[model samples]
Target: MTTTKPNMHAVAINPATWPRQTYFYYFTKIAPSGFSLTVNMDITATLAWTKAHHVKFNAVYLYLVSRLLTTHPEMRIGYLNDQLVTFDVLHPSYTILHANRTMANLWTTYDTDFETFYQHYLADQAEFSALPGPMPKTPQTPNLVNIGCLPGVHFSSYTPLPFKPLDSFFPIFQAGQFKKDADKTIMPLSITVNHATIDGDHLSRFFNELQSCWEQPTQYLA
Candidate 1:
């Protein structure tokens, strides 16, 4: 796919002011992932775009997600080491399944170009699968968001909570199996974010951006 440089900075943050400080106390008590929000979106266009272009769905998904996350810094803010910290460059870490049905974590940094990000994504999968039972929790850095795919099942809504704690600020995204809903091919996408750190407005904006980009793949993904 063709691409252009991103409008945001690659890796730099303004330490002078922390945008989410006001919600820190609330989030700390409510649990980052505890009182989180999950939204299921219709990504019919997303599936169509990847299939038409012969691009890996998850790879394209990670790229699109990274673009959105980088654009919204509030989603990337997390409480680490007892201090509120924002990442200069928050990458994506996804879960990959093995032949034995086990899962391993794989990570890839932010790459503005979809083709390059896809290449690195493939390499990371191969590199991680070759070795180890359960992969390490941490990837390239703490400034990484969690993204995964659940191609086997299609669900209306899902929460990655029971497994993760409430205070976990890292965002979790998963794409489910696509099914036909009348004439349109619809796919389920769930995004989980901390309630205290991020509000509904941020999520609404993300959905708006995603819908726009998916509707016009050639403009954004191409």
Candidate 2:
């Protein structure tokens, strides 16, 4: 509930500067004493929005996480014990096209919230559609690059563990209204943690709570 600027400095590095694979990096601190466990929830939900309004899914996703942040202000994301620490926010990986010469690469960028970034995604789609000829599969991740303001963090498509039941729990899909043909989506959230802060049991409970959240996104939308 307090908002004095932090004298502590946490550097937000450009994704281009980071290795494509995940890493255990220092983000922020949790408690005066290091936390003994960390948990990440991969929440998947069935949205009722279309591809055009797919951005709405992002908006709703962001809204839910932002609300959690506001209510649980203590859950702010930062560095803890030399690991990337995130608050109660649900980070979703968004698929975007990336251009590498004639070959276009499909990749994802993490968005802490959906509203702002989805707007940008839609704008870019419009801008690119106006251009000529055989467009690649889709628009590449755009030339715009910044740190932590809008794009948030970038992530690659993560295939969950092969187990079907457990794999079904992760969230990893594009925004679109659920239809018979629309593939089922799961939000697979991932975080690298320092052993000093969290444990596997805590991770299980985190997934449980996250499941509760996605089961009813509106309940937490307040």
Candidate 3:
């Protein structure tokens, strides 16, 4: 974990000026569950990079995702204490799959350096792998983005439903196993974000930007 305290000064959203003011009330109170969207992404570069470097695909992809979230501030918005606040830095709180098929939820503070982040992640992964019990609760931090990967199967369109109504604006991202598709290699990904904070415009830019980075591993690795 990064000992450095996060410089996470946030600005409170003025509901009066908030664009979602009209629906925000119902979305937060009246609606049983907040709106969510899931899309399957093609991650050919992810597969290729993992094959060439012999590194775990999840670790490498997480690094890329951390970079993406760092650049996209809107993706960091979260509702806390009946108010909306945008975080300056968002960290990862994801599931670590153990060899025994059990998984534990863990959080690792994000680092700009991929190797540094991966090393800390691996350490936590090792610790969690040794202890098997009920799945740990993911920390409910405003600065933590929810992430998990499913290496078991690939589906065309899959949506992960939350246990309870999610009023928070933070993002949830999931990756599926990579498989061969004709002459191309592809991987599946799903992103669920609170509609209050993210819209079609945001998703358009986000998907394009992430895909660009994934397709050019060497560019980002530098």
What are the candidates' C-alpha RMSDs?
4.8, 13.0, 3.0
lDDT of each: 0.68, 0.35, 0.71
TM per model? 0.80, 0.34, 0.82
List model 2 lDDT by residue over 123-168, tens digit each: 5444543344444224332211111111233333222233332101
Q: At residue 115, what lDDT does model 1 achieve? A: 78
Q: How large an RMSD does model 2 have? A: 13.0
Cα lDDT for residue 107, model 2? 17
Ranking by lDDT: 3, 1, 2
Q: Per-residue lDDT for 54 in model 2?
A: 44
lDDT per residue for candidate 3 within 29-84, as digits (tens), equals 67534344455556777667777877777777778887898788778777556668
By TM-score, how accurate is candidate 3?
A: 0.82
Candidates ranked by TM-score = 3, 1, 2
- Give candidate 2 misplaced runs (Cα > 4 Å): 1-45, 49-95, 99-189, 220-222
Estimate the lDDT of model 3: 0.71
Better of 1 and 2 by lDDT: 1
Q: What lDDT, from 0 to 1, does candidate 1 have?
A: 0.68
